[model samples]
Target: MSVISAIFVVLITILMPPAGVFAISGCSVDFFVNICLTLLGYLPGHIHAFYLEYVYYDRKEQNRLGRFAARPAPGVYSDRIQSGGQGYGTIVEDPLVQSEEGRAGATGQ
Candidate 1:
């Protein structure tokens, strides 16, 4: 949101908390919650609206989880930290398992 829009939202929030939340978010859960809270008390509604609009705005609207999560958009998986390659998170086969299989094959079992 731009500076003017932000200021307008804040002013609306002060005057009518539910309206402010509706402006920030659409007919979402937050908007409904704001309505309920406003009915309950102006202070509670105002507080909740402020927290939603400014603090927890979540501009991207993507995963709330941290960066380790899978990419939402399709692209070359770049896991430079761990595997250090541009590919999907492929699991490395265990050396012990490979050795066990080789021994079993030698016995023809």
Candidate 2:
């Protein structure tokens, strides 16, 4: 989490227990509060709603810009469009998890 996010969580904890729960769990306030209010059938607190799209897009843009500004090693892509290397295609795919049985066998899952 970013420093600003951490500070925000701290502030939430100081103000509202439910908000603190959402922040600490790394969940969006919208979903959490929505469920709570729905169950109670009443309006909830005045906390700001989370904007997933805005946050996601902003972060993605930052990483994309970082790619070009930062040089990546050969054969290894950073997944950032701006500063990655051509050797690795500048992107690294996350590995899939294997089941216990698959891990024990020589054949790939």
Candidate 3:
């Protein structure tokens, strides 16, 4: 999602928390939870929706951009990777894929 879309979602959240969460997360567990929260109280729904969004709006885009330049930590490892072109990005790995590859290499050896 883009910044403009994010802003729109935020505005929607302010007016109707559940609707905004539905827009962001779709009809998932979060949506059901938001519905319950909204039923219990308005504030809780708002809190949950905002927490869910948090500009985490574009994971795949950031991951795609992460392939390019980034300044790693000077020593050991930095939890974060900073890029001049964008803000920051972190690579998400699939453990299943890693394990499969590892097993294949070991069996071949």
Residues 1-109, candidate 2: write the lDDT tens digits: 4557646755664455446444433344444653465356422432222222223334445565653223433321113211211223444543453455556686663
Better of 2 and 3 by TM-score: 3
lDDT of 2 at 103: 67
Inter-residue clash pairs, candidate 2:
67-82, 67-83, 68-82, 68-83, 77-90, 77-91
Best by TM-score: 3
Residues 1-109, candidate 1: write the lDDT tens digits. 4567778988999999988877766566667878888999988898888776654233222223322224322221212211211224666566899999999999999
The whole-model lDDT of each prediction reads 0.61, 0.40, 0.64
Candidate 3's displacement at residue 29, Å, is 0.8
Q: In angstroms, how far off is 32's CA in candidate 1?
A: 0.8
Greater-lDDT candidate between 1 and 3: 3
- TM-score of candidate 1 to 2 decimals: 0.51
Per-model TM-score on C-alpha atoms? 0.51, 0.25, 0.56
